[model samples]
Target: MPVVFIHGVATRAGEQYQRGVAAREELIRRLLVDRMAASDPRWAGMQVVSPYWGDLAVRHYWAQATLPPVGTLEDMGVGDDGVAAADLEVADLVKEIGNDATGLEALGAETPLRNAWSKNPHRTVEALLAPIVHSDRSVLRPQDLGITEQARPAQALGEIDGRVLAAGSLAASDEAVGAAIRDALSDDAALTVITDAIVARTEQVAPVEASTDSALESLGPGWLDTLRDRVGEVLNRAKSAPARVATLAALDRYRDGLHGHLTLFMGDVFVYLLRRGEAGSPGPIVERVREAIADAPRSRADEPLIVLTHSMGGNIFYDLVTTYEPSLKVDLWVSAGGQVGQFEEMKLFKASTVVDPPAPPMPPKVAALGGRVRTWLNIYDPADILSFLVEPVFTDPDAGVRIKDLKFKSGVSALKAHGAYYSRPTFYELLGREFGSRP
Candidate 1:
């Protein structure tokens, strides 16, 4: 089988882009190609072709002049000169804990699908970390647990320290930690234990409190008390202000990401829309995809063609196959986190000639693809703002076009969901089961 993957927008040409392409190729090799080969050797040599279009992406002439400055921690009213470092440390720790908690929640929720997708403990743990990290939970507190700080910190610290050490060991290789996470996901008892430990560590045995205690124990309460008195309440602000830190930090991050990413996103989309020339004179990006599809290798004289597109790539291909090359063969066209339906609804794409349903006939372009493209699987995430349902957009039953709109939980929030699809093994697993096993 020959697979062509057209990437989404905001993809700039760099080592990161190269890695993404390579990673997708490997994912297909392991999840789809390798599995298909197990059933039939003919698919043993499945070829994956990922074309680059990021180089032609939107560019800002004025650079920073056009974009507003991203606010620093100081600008967010985080200035206690003496404890600036401590405040940053607390903020970072709180963010990490929040992310871990969210990951644990996603794993717990998706246990069945995760287990079905992969048996490897390492892969399982990796799947846990696959979700987007944008959690902003309130700071875990000892009072909430109905325990005094003194009663739990000692024992809890030991247990939590052990878990941390185990996590740290995996940190060096990164693989070890993911395996532990995956193992924890499989067992509820284990997951609960990990969750409690994390909560305890965050609330009872926080580094801020630990350091304060250490100072008091070594230098005597008198000296520390004197120092605290000198610094006044500001000395304790970082410890008591984690909620503020986490909130402000999350806001800042969201603001920065939205501004930066939205620019390139809109830029690339507009660039493609404005520049995509007429049928005979296709744009550079369109030509790149067309050439890639044409050059895609087939194992046999007649192998089924699979074209997988993400984000704007889906829109580009939708126009390409519909108007430019109406007879192009696409056995399986999977549009994950795409806006093909939305663009058509907005009358943006070149092939948007169809009147909405109740008016019998489907759009010429859509009906054309319905006949040629054997399977039009539209995988979308409810959490993703960018992902839209095609079935609702193009609902012409007589057209013989059935676009499967699958609800895949790609990420936890809008910030992460759009980009989270490709990172998920579960996504690949679904693809493998859906079309990889077909004859």
Candidate 2:
């Protein structure tokens, strides 16, 4: 058996994209393919193939300049936190910088056979600079600053919580600790100020009082110089902009994350509709899918051909199997968070032949798929606004096995639910139980 994965819109070529594909492949292999093999030996060695068609998706000629910026406070429906509703969605971006830095320091602490201070000298330096850089808070008690490895973890963790608090603060007033952090983070000379302060403090505090110059020397001087630069890069995003402007910036990112992807989703839909080309000369997107199907291993006649499509990819496959290549056989068709039913209802697809004014139960093109597609499983999340019910829109009582619409609760916020299917291990578990484990 071979499983073909068709990705949705708003996808691009990047590290995140690559990581997502790899994760999906490995997950499908474990949850679905392994279960199928367990049920029947014929399903052994099933390969998961994800064909890339994101290149043919929407392109912004004006560099997406048409998109609007963050709205005014009143327009955004300001929340109790004083951050706009949209801004609240993306506030994690501001928090993650400090969290990552703290996590790095924590990782250093856990690194065995080495003192936490020596494991990540840069993070230690970052912590040391935090009090002077942002505000004066006693992160390290005098007792915690001892030179021994036993006391080093406490010293390493000294200023992490304070730094996080400062960076994550969204206080309205300029006198707030967050404001101080933002100012310090933005200053070009802050690094120099921090470096000089650290040198003075280290000289005055540790080795001179405790006579542990060799321990300080063990970390080397090169580390001291490079550490500031690295930590500077680490905290660069924590500053962003301050006060109201900072909220707007966060809102802007939220809109781009959601609305921008939605714009591209519609763009991909339109692009596929207008430029699908004839069967003889299929467009780049359709042609890509055709090639993937053709490449599937069919050494044994009994081998099942499974097609898993997400979001717009579902519509693409539905159109391809029904109209572009009617003979194309899909033993199992799994659509997650897709719009095929909605597209059919709207009569947008090339194969859409469902008449209006008391519209027919099943579109002719969809009925045609009954022969080629053995089992159609449509998965939709209640929170996902984009996913639609295929069973209601397309049905064939005579066929006995109609499209099964499984209502899944993705336990994510509405804005984040649509793209949450593939990333969830529980989603794969559902697929295994519904389709793969069956004899």
TM-score of each: 0.62, 0.58
What tens-digit string does per-residue lDDT give for candidate 2 at 1-439? 4889999888887534544454455446545765787977766667777899988878899977887774433443333332232232223222322233442232222211112122322232333323222222223322333434543332232222222222211111123322333345323343334333433333322221121112223332332333334334433322321233333443543454466667887888788888888767788899899888898665366778989999989988987987788888777889999999998878777777646654456434356476678789999999899999887677654465657998776444476668767654456656766764631
Candidate 1 lDDT, 1-439, residue by residue in tens: 4878899998886433443444455455545665777776666666778888987778888874678887645456544322232333334333333233442242233343223223333232232322111111111222322334454332222222222222211232244334454565543433443333333322322232221122113222222222212222221343343444444463444564468778889999989988888888998889888988898777786667888899999998999988777879777788999999888767787776646663556444344364667778999989788999887665434455456888886424455678756545567656665755531
Candidate 2: misplaced stretches above 4 Å?
71-253, 298-301, 354-356, 359-366, 397-400, 436-439
Listing every candidate in turn, what is its Cα RMSD in Å to the true structure after a full C-alpha superposition? 16.0, 17.3
Candidate 1 deviant stretches above 4 angstroms: 40-42, 74-124, 127-248, 354-366, 395-402, 435-439
Cα displacement (Å) at residue 338, model 1: 0.7
State residue 321's C-alpha deviation in candidate 1, in Å: 0.4
**What lDDT is obtained when candidate 1 is compared to the true structure?**
0.55
Q: Model 1 misses residue 407 by how many Å?
A: 0.7
Residue pairs with backbone atoms closer than 3 Å in model 1 (clashes): 125-182
Among all windows of 10 consecutive residues in model 1, the one with the lowest summed lDDT is: 131-140
